[model samples]
Target: RSPSLNLSFLYFCQLMATRGRGRGRVGRGGRAGRGGRGGDQQPDPLNQQQPPIFQQPPPHQHPPVFQQPPPNQGQNHVQIMGQFRVLSPPTFTGADGPQAVDDWFMNLERIFEVLNYSDQEKIVCSRFQMIGDAGRWWSDVWRLKTTAERDAMTWEQMKLLISERYYPYHFREQMERQFYALQQGNLSVEEYEREFTRLSHFAPHMVDTDFKKSRRFLNGLQKDLRFVLSSHGYLTYAETILRAQQIAASQRLELDAAQQTVAQPRMIQPVSVQPPSFQPVQVQPAVYQQSSAQPSGSGGKRNFEGKKKKNQQNKKGGNGGRGDRQPAQQTPRARPP
Candidate 1:
């Protein structure tokens, strides 16, 4: 062989040795080395098991997707409910008047304010409190709404719905009238203010402003209190109430003082006069005089005797004789047999 031929043979041998080393490396770890066909007979791609072509996930098997709630959502809900029940919230049954419904709403609002509840939370809490007729009514109302509408329901909307059902228009009108006619006649200042505040809800437009509220409150006050408060410039409702209370207290004190200072009428003791003593006069018995001579039956005979006697007396006087006149003889009367 020529020198070029020998050089070619040596290059071929080096090439073969490099290829053998490459094959050994592949046989140790490459796919073809792992019990696969050792040659360039690349396993038929069609027959080779490809990594499961990532088969389009079965209709049921979806990609890892996330939902709205976390794994501990139920636990969180239970915790919230536990906290809510601790407040001792009030319930409703639609068995009372419109006022009762309003009171229930007010009570719930107070509790909600303390809890800082959101509108949806308020709706949830309020619904949980409904029972009996109230629960049934809410069910009907709820059935009328779509899921979106239900989810979007706000606290005010819930109140309005309950109001519409339990608090009818006529009843609300009546309450408004009562609110307008409310007076502080016999109620104390605090009591009157409380009542006024409560009824004010029925006619919100009437007392929309402080001036109107003050005016309305003044109008309902007693005549004396109203008179005293009316003389000053406009005041807020609270200020007016405070002033009226002060005036009322002063008036009561004045009345008490006047009562204490007033002197009670003195009871007069009746004068007893002793009656005059009566003196009895002693009466004397009359004495009886008996005549010595009996009466004569003949009146003529007695007259003749009397004339004779008188004549005798005159003769004696004429002769100046001191002779005594003799008594005439009396004739006795005979008794009839």
Candidate 2:
């Protein structure tokens, strides 16, 4: 071979060796380096070292960046519902009367207050509790509203809607009449106050002010209580109620005490004993008279003879003895010898 040709062949062999070594280094790295001379060369998958079947992958130098998906609106609503149900909210059916609807609204509002619910949340929770006819009615109403309208609806607006449906004008009128006519009657102060508070909502215009409220409550009280309370100066409704209750309690206590006094048995005082008085009695003695005794038969014979002679002389001389009538002659008595 010629010398020049042999020299060129050696240079070409050296260049081929350098290129082959660079490819081996790249294969060892398991991937191509950045800014490689070749245009986007891919490493041979077969030549790359495979990780052990059971070996865990290397821990990330920086935690692998993960993009969080957006929150699901339906999931948020379900969570809210679950939280509301824990409070044991009351369910409503349109079959119940207007009073039931009112009571349901009151209860839901109380729960809403406790939970610090927003207006939207209140509307959502209220609609969730409705069932049966009430549910269907609300669904019908809801269907008529557009998305924007429904979203814009406030809790007060919802309440107005419900009221329009369940609480008719006639019913409200009847409630107002009853409220106006309400009297304490046989009801206790507490009970009358409860009824008054309940009915006041039906006729808000009448007792819009505290003074009007107090006056109205006073008017409904029992006659004696009203008369007593009417004499007092202006007072808040709460103060009036407290005073009335106190007076009633005091009166009841007095009545109970009087009844107890009457029911108790009376005590009788013991009578003093007196001794009997004794008086001495006087006695009278009997008196006896002594008679003169005549000598036996002689005296008796002489007296008899004299008495006979005197009697015969008196008869013969009738005119000698005072004027007329003759005396009767006496008979001589025989004497024992």
Candidate 3:
């Protein structure tokens, strides 16, 4: 046999022996593969006559897609009523009661919340940013910034010093004030509840028990919701809040429907026909009657009688001449307007 024929024959036999295992492993690694390995594998030669062309990958059968999540808008995100205000922080005033202290502290916290601040220390340091009366107050609180004073300055220390100086009964006074005034003004149930929760934090003793807390909250609700929530018979604060929220939602729907009804123009209702027994009042049109030689009213009757009597008297006087004229006709003369 020829050398080339012998070589070709040897290659064919080697391919048959190794084909099964090599086919399974070729063109893919476990997990980290393209389309993946399969039984229908094509053979690749160890050596090629020419360099191979790299074919482009096929387009996706199903493309990877992305969907955006919907915005979660609760009561916090109310409609833009007026322009957003960057409110000034309140500074510590001198020798005020717990009420003043509470107001100042709450104001400080509010400004921080509005500015999306998290650091308490940063919030405390920001007191220096106050102006006018507040500026004076801040100066009093933070005098000459010596190295020793700066080292001692902390959020807790500031709070402690301020509380001790301004508010002796900070706990008791705050609890009393908050408990006394927690009315639900113009806010919705969700909005009111958020405020209620915030204020309730100041008065832990008043709201120590869920039962007492629920009662207190119930008392503060507006008349309409208070009446509705009362009837539902929920015990715990959580349950009462849930039930009130449901009522509020339903009330909102009703209000929306009512507003829609009011906004749109309505068809005028037809007036009912009057009964024959209750006839329409007949309005007499004024008549401008021509006045006769002798009119028909009482004055006309008197004038006619007077003329007849005079003629009779003249007849009695017998055939008098034209010169013998009885005084001119006694007709009523109209007064000049």
Q: What is the number of residue pairs that collide in model 3?
A: 0
Candidate achieving the largest lDDT? 2
The local lDDT score (0 to 100) that residue 310 gets in candidate 2 is 76
Q: How do the residues 67-108 of candidate 2 rate in per-residue lDDT, one tens digit apiece?
A: 999779888788889889999999999788898888998899
In model 2, what is the error at residue 286, expressed in angstroms? Answer: 48
Give the Cα lDDT of each candidate: 0.82, 0.84, 0.67
What ordering of candidates by lDDT runs from best to worst? 2, 1, 3
How many collisions between residues are there in candidate 1? 0
Off by over 4 Å in 1: 1-73, 266-337
lDDT-superior candidate, 1 or 2: 2
Query: Which is better, 1 or 3, measured by lDDT?
Result: 1
> What is candidate 3's CA lDDT for residue 142?
71
Give all TM-scores, in the order shown.
0.57, 0.57, 0.34
- Could you tell which candidate, 2 or 3, scores higher by TM-score? 2
lDDT of 1 by residue, 290-334 (tens): 666545568658877887898788777764443564557899999
Q: Single out the weakest 10-residue window by summed lDDT for candidate 3.
A: 75-84
